[model samples]
Target: MKNISKIFMFLLIIAIPQIAFAESSKIGVVDLQKVLNESAKGKEAVKLLEVEFEKKKKELDIKENDIKKLEEEISKRGSLWSEKVKQEKEEDYDKKVKDYRRLQTDLKDEFQRKNKNFTDKILSDIIELVRTVGDEEKFSLIMEKQNAIFTSSTIDITDKVIKLYNGKEKGEK
Candidate 1:
């Protein structure tokens, strides 16, 4: 009888802790995209990228206009000129068109590369911040809002995290 009591007590001790831990564990969902879009640092990063893209776009437009003008000049007087002059004009126009096309391709590639780099950096930072906040708040699980089909407002931590991230950006750490 004494041995039986001791075994029961041991089992109870083990089970009680597990039950308590399960009850106390907290789970939350956050909209990562929303947080990133709303955060002050994210906004600043977007603005910086936009400014750079605009400058590049303007340069591309100017190059395109120059190419168009060269093409028009060549077309208007090609047959009226001597063979040598016509051939030279055709060569110049071809070279200019090729250069313009190459420049346009490079600009597009560069813009994509820059945009991807900036997005990756921002996402990495946001993930770090989310983990830090989750650990500090003792969240047992944190899920992205996109992955979750539904969650109650009480379990939604999107707004709180955005606030915290913005606050940190403002030197309120």
Candidate 2:
């Protein structure tokens, strides 16, 4: 009877670990890039950035047109004027050209900075939402799809996340 009890104890110990291992872990994959591109907030951010870009582009276009006009005026009248007057006009043209170039560079830099900041902010918000979704769905682990070597479509949660993010942005909850 002692031997039977000992055998039973040994079998239970072996089976306990097997039973624990049999439970599946709930893991999910989220594609952040998809979230950024498909989410409504993300699309709104892109539109805002594009509008700002077009506004800045118009400013640069005006500066460029002014430069072209000055260049043409210099070419048409430079030969008819006295040396001093011609020299002054030439200097003015050079200054305008330099100013236009500087303005162009500055506007480009500003646009790029704004774009980077907007992208970063959106990505940060999405990551926070991903965490919240993971918690609510009882995920044991959530990984970025880009970082994973392979993940099945059944475990991909990007669409669900996007839906939740959009709903959140619209004040649905």
Candidate 3:
């Protein structure tokens, strides 16, 4: 009976700390996607990116149309032209096509680079904010929504974080 009591005491001692830790643990969840999509700065950043890319997109469209027209002309008029003229036209068409493709690739690469930079900057700001929130609120663990298997709405701090982020952006501007 004395040995049983000692074993019981040891188990109780181990379990008590775990129970206390579970009770004290404060977890928070943030949906970064939600914050990025819903925040004012995020929305504005998207609009800016779109506007910045729109001009290049229009230019690409025009270039594509020009290429198509040239292709049509080559097909329709090549038979009527002398060999030299036909060959020259075909060469010009090929060169233009190559130029168009290169420009398209350059534009795509630039857009992706800009987008990643913007996303990184914004997400960096958000993570800083999350850290601040976690510290201030005494959260034991704060996790990204995507990383979690499931989270209760009560533990979700996304809206709160978004509000804070928007306010910070407003203050900055």
Candidate 4:
């Protein structure tokens, strides 16, 4: 057992230099969310998305108000209303609720689709930019800043990536 321990220590000593060398590799970190928030194209995309969101919000609000009014009427006058009338009102309310729920789901899906499109395009461009930067700057590895804990500013290439990505976005526009 002692001989095995000695051999293990010997192997560990031999591996130290390789571990040190690996740590010395040219690694970079990029803050992709920062790039998306600060870049011109990203700003434009957000603004457009917000417009769509607001437009849908207005429609939902109007429908919601109508539903509220109907509910109030049913509640206040339902006792005096004929049985058939009360039943019709209840059915109408139910249908409106169903429509509202369906519309909400549809809007959510539409927003997600738009968001995915923007993200997919932006991420694809960022990947290409990262590749170019990696090749030009001779980076051995690049990781997202979101996953990092204590990366030195010297290895933070987020600004460069954003600049390169924005340049490409400008050219494409």
Candidate 5:
């Protein structure tokens, strides 16, 4: 009977660890890039940026046309004009060209700034939504999808994040 009791105790010790390992931690992942691309708020922000881009492009186009016309005028009539007059026209054209280039640079910088601001805001909103989902679902860990090389499809919560982001956007409006 003592031998039987010792055998049962050994079996119980082995099974105890197995039972502890049976309960798994709930982990979730979110694809932030996909959320930014697929979400409605992201799309709207893109559209607004595009509109601003087109507007700047048109202004640049008009300035470019003006430059081309000035160059053509100099080519056609520069030889007949006084040296002083030709020099002045050349200076004017140079200044205009410089201004156009500067404006182009400024527009690009502005666009980048605006894009960063938009992304920062959106990313924060996503983080908030992720936290909410994690809390509600009782997830033990929520990781960025890009960080994981191998995750089950069941653990991917990017779609859930996008859905929540869009819903939150709607509520704000």
Candidate 6:
């Protein structure tokens, strides 16, 4: 009788972990990149950025044209110009080119900084929404789909997250 009780105790101990695991909340996956691409706010943000970039590109093109014309004029009058005057003109052109390059660099840096900030803000909001959904759905863990090679549809929460995010953005509860 004592041997039977000991055997039962060992079996119970082994079964406890399996039972706990079976009852535990499941891990869910979300494709964050897909969410961002499909979200309405994300699409709008992308369009705005593209427009701003195009404007800056146009401005740069104008500056480039001006520099090219200056160089052409200088070359055309080279035969009639004094060596010192030619050197001065070349120096002025070089300075303008340098300044334009600096401006280009600054613009690029500013664009990158702004883009990063914008994306970070959006991602933060999305993360909050994801957390809320996970909590409501009793998810034990929520992983990014990008990190996972495969996940069952039962555990995929991408659409739910996107819907929640967009709904919040639209002032929907």
lDDT of 3: 0.95
Write one digit per residue (lDDT tens) for candidate 1, span 49-167: 88988888898789888878877877897778999998988898788778878988998898789777877887887788879978999999999989988888899888888887888
Off by over 4 Å in 6: 1-15, 74-80
**Model 4 residue 101 lDDT?**
91
Model 5 poorest 10 in a row by lDDT: 17-26
Q: Rate the local accuracy (lDDT) of all candidates.
A: 0.85, 0.88, 0.95, 0.90, 0.92, 0.86
Per-residue lDDT of model 5, residues 1-173, tens digit only: 99999999999999988777656568899999999989998898889999989989899999999999999999999999999999999999999999999999999999999998998888888999999999999898999999999999999999988988999999999
Compared with the true structure, what per-residue lDDT tens digits does model 4 show for residues 1-173? Answer: 99999999999999999899797779999998998888887888999999979989899989999999999999999999999999999999999999999999999999999998998898887888888899898888999998988899999998888887778877888
Judging by lDDT, tell me the better candidate of 2 and 3. 3
Best by lDDT: 3
**Clashes (N, CA, C under 3 Å) per candidate:** 0, 0, 0, 0, 0, 0
RMSD of each: 4.9, 5.7, 1.4, 3.7, 4.8, 3.4
lDDT of 4 at 93: 99
Cα RMSD (Å) between model 5 and the true structure?
4.8
Q: How close is candidate 2 to the true structure, as a TM-score?
A: 0.73
**2 or 6, which is superior by TM-score?**
6
TM-score of 4: 0.84
Model 3: worst 10 consecutive residues (lDDT sum): 111-120
> TM-score for each prediction?
0.74, 0.73, 0.94, 0.84, 0.80, 0.80
- RMSD after Cα superposition, model 1: 4.9
> Which pairs in model 6 have colliding backbones?
none
> Model 2 clash tally?
0
What is the C-alpha lDDT profile of model 2 across 1-173, one tens digit per residue? 99999999999999998787656568899998889889998888889988878987897888789888888887998788999998998898889889888988888788789878988998898889888987888888999999999999999999999998898889954
How many clashing residue pairs, candidate 4? 0
Better TM-score candidate (3, 5): 3
Query: What is the clash count of model 5?
Result: 0
Pairs with backbone N, CA or C atoms under 3 Å apart (clashes), candidate 3: none
